[model samples]
Target: MSMAQWVETYGQGTVLAAGGVLIGLSFGFWAQRSRFCLRAAVIEFWHRRFGEKLSVWLLAFASAVIGVQLMVLMGWLDTGSARQISAKGSISGALIGGMLFGVGMVMTRGCASRLLVLSANGNLRALLSGLIFAVTAQAALGGALSPLRTHISSWWTVEGGAPRDLLAIAGVDHWAGLAMGGLWLAAALFFALRSPQRSVWMWLGGMGTGLSVAAAWGFSQWVAAESFDPVQIQGLTFSGPSAEWLMRVMHWPAPPIGFDFGLMPGVFVGSLIGALVGRDWKLEGFSDGYSMRRYIGGAILMGFGSMLAGGCAVGAGVTGGAIFALTAWLSLVGMWVGAGLTDRWLDGGAADKPTSLPAEGFKRP
Candidate 1:
């Protein structure tokens, strides 16, 4: 093909990749600045009775809903681009997966994405979790459990032959869905605002979390629609991509790096750079072999759970929320419940404990 033709043919992947880079950078920066971790959110909420972290998470959800809804309304994206919303899947799997993921995150002291960023910051424990998460996720995606995932997903169906998203469940149009989602967002904001530490940074953190997912979705749609001469299209989420990258290195004939793959690496790299730039990079390890064991176990559960659930907090929680996917909501609730239970269990039935923020900070070299 001529140069012009080549540009026309290859431009989509390029644009999509660019968008992914933006999304990754934005999320890494925002997350680092805001200290937004779902495990931390739940822990702080229960222990300190502080809602800042929770509020940040809620804001992200609301922002994602609004951004994606607006994109759909503006014809920038088809709502179907969201996989968790449009794809057929088992609610039971999502719940089970989410619960497992939640418990694992608590045991590991971080979720999949959190582990990735933390590993980048030089947390050896997190590095171990990231490694296990990647392997288990791959196994679940196309390994021994793949059949189970497929079988269960195939058997489950929603009412009215509707899409598995929240809007469909409510029997509402896109606009109505957006409005309802916005209301939830508003409630999150209201609750956040009630916090004594209210500030612009907190609001931004919440909105950024949600917006990051919307951007990833839009970017995915753009890439998937684009025709690339030698490349494929993809979107965000940490679990599968991590494993895929490893597989690609070991086995040739792997698909070309796409938006999702690029974004995942970008988040890891971006966070590392951010930590270094902020002079926050440090190398750390587990306190003991027991801590190491718990971390690895947590990572394995998180990996398997994220695979079965169809995404991690960012993937299913924020991105799925943007599309109002019922499974996503279920997964989020399951994660929270699992996390709460894990925390309590860890504490030996002690219902009351002070919130434990990472004392060493999450920066790594």
Candidate 2:
């Protein structure tokens, strides 16, 4: 059946929510299996150890870039109307917010998406941190912290369109973007082959995770085209979704069921299934008061930073980067730099050593 027919039968909200669930489920399953965390990759990069973590992240990122660019080249995709490209963006917000998020992820030992995935795998520490992160994200979105975010965002703003489109700014086309993705994929393959920790999941899961991002874009665009109702063309993102979920629980008049509405729950259930199948599910908590404080602090930073930056790691870093969004690239670079510096400062000489988590699968090498 056609998407329009499906929407007509099931309603636009239902169709969109179902699409979100499917996309989120795939993303969560692949991410959990691959243990794809930007925090681990950044740590490995800074420590000068190109290991499995770094390779997995590179593979996912390169795949997303390739997938998105390929669709654009084939005339099957249009990102021109996407908010990341069409909306006014902030340089100051991307830099500062990205750095803050990077620092927070290092402190928490996981990025926003990683935390959610781990939480689903029965990690109490992750569950708590995820809750705190959601709360803070809500606060930043429209709560007390909104003013600060607005102030920071206003420091330096760029008009949408050509200014935000990295491909346009570079004077290149989608083919150039696709070629860049190819180079990154080659580098990812080289690293993956050499890594001693290579495994089946690393290859399959990394690629799957990236492909999921592209699927989200395609699915949303298709739905928007077919549905008579105005539907947003969005990909995977956690910050706004988290905040939306939090509000749903606390306030009345629930928001309309959309992609974000189903995404969080879908990811949770998908991660749970992945964990059970992989026998990686485990309950864990803070070992000490200091550790608890660290997690909470990190959560707060991540929540606020993700909102300020307009996206979390996976949202802006991979999804937006694939579309060659200028702000997304800047935010990604800031994340890397901030993560590296924070790791060096916080861990010192032990930065190269793997920090074993309470759970077995989450260990950073």
Off by over 4 Å in 2: 354-360
Q: Which candidate is the best by lDDT?
A: 2
Clashes by residue pair, model 1? 60-206, 60-210, 121-364, 166-324, 282-364
What's the C-alpha lDDT at position 229 in model 2?
81
Strongest candidate by TM-score: 2
Q: Can you give the lDDT of residue 198 in candidate 1?
A: 66
Q: Mind giving the per-residue lDDT tens digits that candidate 2 earns over 183-239? A: 999999999999999999999999999999999899898898899888779888898
- The true-versus-predicted C-alpha distance at residue 222 of model 1, in Å, is 3.2
The number of clashing residue pairs in model 1 is 5
Model 2 residue 216 distance off true place after TM-score fit, in angstroms: 0.5
Off by over 4 Å in 1: 1-15, 46-48, 151-161, 198-200, 224-235, 348-365
Report residue 304 deviation for candidate 1 (angstroms).
Answer: 0.7
